[model samples]
Target chain A: MTTNGGADLTRLIEPDRVHRSVYTDDAIFAREMEAIFQRAWVYVGHESQVKQPGDYCTALLGQQPLIMVRHSDGAVYVLYNRCAHRGALLCAKSRGNTGGAFGCSYHSWQYRTDGTLESIPLPAGYEGTRFSPGAADYNLKRAARVESYRGFVFASLSPSGPALAEFLGEARIALDNMCDRAPAGEVEIVPTCFRFIQHSNWKIFMENQLDALHPYVTHESTGRAAAELERQMMARKQKPPLEYHYLSAFTTPFNEWDKLQTVNYPYGHCMLQGYMGLRPRDPDTLAYEAVMREHYGAERTERILGVNIHHVLIYPGLSVQPALQQLRAARPLAPNRTLTEIWHFRLKGAPEAIYRRALAYYNLINSPSTMVNADDLENFWRCHQGLAADGGDWVSFHRNAGQDDEHDGVIASRRGTSEAPMRNQFRAWKQYLSSSEH
Target chain B: MPVVIKKRSRKKAITPKKNSFAQFRVSDDDVILREVEQFLYRQAELLDAKRWSDYIELFDADGIYWMPASLEQITGDGMPSIFYEDRNLMTMRMKRIAHPHAWSQTPAWGTSHIVSNVTLEKVDSRTGDVSVRSRFHMMEFRRDASRHFAGVYHHELRKTKHGYTIRLQRTDMVNGEAPFDYVLLAWV
Candidate 1:
């Protein structure tokens, strides 16, 4: 468990508790960036973000800036954002079309969309020197490996590891369910996202996405207010819109949340069973269902809609609510700083009303301005602050430790409130940190 | 806090009453402009005072409070927005913020708004509707942190018997795309 400096990393994690330093120590955070984020197939960006040949988007993979660009060869490439010549950033914007090549702002060195060196200024100056344009070093350095599943692209910094699909395993259902919901069996990104920085660690945000017990407690006020309004509307003989229930559902009692289940997969991935009843007989929903039925037939449509997934945590980075068409990607900047990109998708060929429903959830429940998100962010900050103080040394994960059902390395929680997801994550974390390879 | 009950109406385009301002002389333009500015000032005051009910009362039954995520966003219907709420949703937000268990509002944040650059963009000569543009800089302080938000405000005011009520209040934040430290809980 100890590294070369004799820092006991193994002692940091226990079966039912974790050392406070895991969330606060700078050395641990740096190790995690190299061991887990760089080794794992980290999510970069959706392929839909760069649909056209020259379109490109920038993302961060464990402090390494990367560009996901579509090439003229009808293939997507993941390359380092740095210019090979002077090490300046190739693309400054978050996303844009590079036209035919990525032109560096500092030196005007241009590389093709596929990251090969297309041209460089002043070729005569480099003729007598060792500098050669054809050298692979002069071309933009690509990720060790890049793969996409259902348009969700991911890249690994290490050359050797499990394939993207093998790593995804059962967790791939999250992406599958989302795509299958679309009549055309595809989903498109909404072009823009809500980028927020939490004054907390990245793991805090990841753990919270599947913490079933906190919603009713943290968002009680929002739920109560929405429920009260719904009551008044019903009293006035009016049916409240479906959007109201989106907040009111937070009032779900703890016992009901316990009735749900969390399935933990290898590689720290986890899934929470759907609790919010997304299906309704509203006119908009009925029309959407009719279209789905027409495109997928009755049996297939029912199966797609019946996936019953609420949220999927593709550990260390992504949290996806497939049924809601929302995904949040977390990027750690420091021990106390984490940046999250919240994105919503439009199900291709689905009715506009369905997209509007997703938009409502995005703005009202997930956006930075929402009461729900505000309370969660507040708690995250407080959790980080408390962990950093000397008041506590160990953070408890003993909710239902020994009660989980395990089969073939997969853990299933007996109750939804079990901390099995955290345990599962640390299990992977320990393996990753203990490995000698970088 | 006493709740104000208002009849809610479905969304409808605000139409100016025909020739409502026909009798007004050119000299009265300044007076009308001052009134619009005063109305906006009052709205800011209510917000700063945490007078949720009073703030909600400034909106028409069908009025919309919108904060677009991008400057290019034209409609709040299909595109994602930071905020797009009708009176009902605003009322819900008001109640939630005032609730005792609203953890984010703990050690309640204080906001000071500076409203300036008030300009009357257009006056509907037919119905007396007014379109006003203004700029605002709001400083919000909580526990140990202070954050500033600067935005341009576009208000569509409907002439009412008592005064002018907001039909639409759109806030276009200059740093809408910038990364926020946490959540934005209050109106700017």
Candidate 2:
């Protein structure tokens, strides 16, 4: 129950509650960066972000800076964004093409797209010394393991662990469903993303993703306003656009939310069943369905569209809404601060209207300017402030604790409002924090 | 309350449509410039006072409010932007923020906008359609935090029967890419 540092891991995380220090303590946060983030298969940039050879984008794995680049040989590599010579950042911008090689701004040390040292200035000065350009230390350090599943790239800092597929487990369906939704069986990332810094711990954001109970309460105002407008429009014999329902869906009563379900998987991954009837009989949707049916037969297209998933939480980091074609990656900055990048995708070969639907959801619900996100962010900040204070010591996850159905390490919540996802996440958290392996 | 009916038209509403204006030299540049400045300052005043309905009324029926995520973003369609909304969406936002249970507005924030650098980019001397450019620094204080948003505002004003109404208001923020502490609850 105790970690090597003598911190009581079991005390920090219980079956139905977690200690406040888990969300506030500096030592615990640092330990999480090492025990979980560094060891887990953390999500990097999608392969679509760097479509062409020599194209590169920077990402953060835990606190480590990394570069996901496409090499001339058409291979993608996730390398540490550091100059091996003087420890300066190799890629200064978020994304750009490095041409043939990355020339460090500080010392002009050149590195191939694959992270191997290509050349260095003043080779003669290092001939008599211990410096060797050909050594592995001089090359940009690559992540211990890098893997892509359907173009979604992930990297692990540890040299040994489960492969990316195993780490994903049943959660891989989230990615599969997204890719399957595309007519070409692929998805491309939208280049720009909204980066938001929440004044709360990373787990707070992750837990809220599949909470299921908070949407109606936290976003009641936004929902009510949309619902009211929808009512007025209906009274006028007018049909409101589907985008209004994106916000009004938050007005879904608590009982209806409970009728939905969440499935928890190992490695802290969890998924919430679809609640927004995304498949409407609108002309745009019908046209999109026709295009999908053209590529995939009726049965297959129906199967693809019928996948009832709303949100999937790949714990400690990513939250994906597969049907909506959007995902958010959380990067912990400090115990009290976390940075989240919100990225959405275009289902390849699908009608542009479908992509616009995803874009509508992205802007209406996920954008920083949205009332939905604003209220959620307020709750996150308030939660952190309350947790850090002396007012409370334990955060409860006691909603329907003993009622969950577990089969072979997979948990299915009896009610969608159940806090089983948090309990399941802490179960993985405890395992990662207590293990001496990394 | 005057209700703005939501149009069900499938037309791309937020797209920056080119207005057909007769290009001609303005005879009274000073008069037009002062009028444009006053209109902009009034818009800012409405925003600062949290006059949501009045602020919404400043826009024409088919007007758009856009805040691009970057300076290079020219088109709002198909690209991710901070905000790209038509009158309907803006009205929806206005109603939502005014809802009593809008938790994010709990300790209701206050915003002060300083409008400067008012320059007339173009003028349609016949119809009075004009393009105006100005810089704005908006300071928003909510709870214990104060944030500053400085941006350039490009307003395409359509001359209406009453006065000029905004056909498009595009904000290019200097800190559009910066890491914000929390959500932006209101327009800046």
- State the lDDT of candidate 1 residue by residue for B79-123, as single tens digits: 788988888888899989989999988875899999998877788
- Give me the TM-scores for chain A across all models, comma-separated: 0.97, 0.98
Candidate 1 ranges with C-alpha deviation above 4 Å:
A1-7, B1-26
lDDT at A14 for candidate 1? 94
Looking at model 1, give its docking quality level: medium
lDDT of 2 by residue, A1-438 (tens): 223452575568889999888888887888889889999999998999998999999999898999999999999999999999889998999999999899999989999999999998878887678888788999999999999999999999999989999999999988999999999999999887888999999999999999889999999999998998889889989888798898899999999999999999999999999988878889989998998999999999999999989999887799999999999999999999999999899999999989999998988887778778898889999999999899878899999999999999999999999999999999999988888344
Cα displacement (angstroms), candidate 2, residue A333, comes to 0.5
Tens digits of per-residue lDDT, candidate 2, B1-188, equal 43334533365465334532222234476688899999999999999999988998998988988998789988887677788888777878889888888998888589999999888888898999999999999999989779999989999999988999999999999998887778777777
All predictions: root-mean-square deviation over Cα? 7.5, 7.8
lDDT of 1 by residue, A1-438 (tens): 223431468668899999888898888888899888988999999999998999999999998999999999889999999998879998889999998999989889999998999998888787679888898999999999999999999999999989999999999998999999999999999987898999999999888889999999999999999999999889989888898998999999999999999999999999999888888789999999999999999999999988888899997799999999999999999999999999999999999999988988999987868879889999999999999899968899999999999999999999999999999989888878878343
lDDT of each: 0.90, 0.89
Which pairs clash in the backbone of model 1?
A: B16-B127, B17-B127
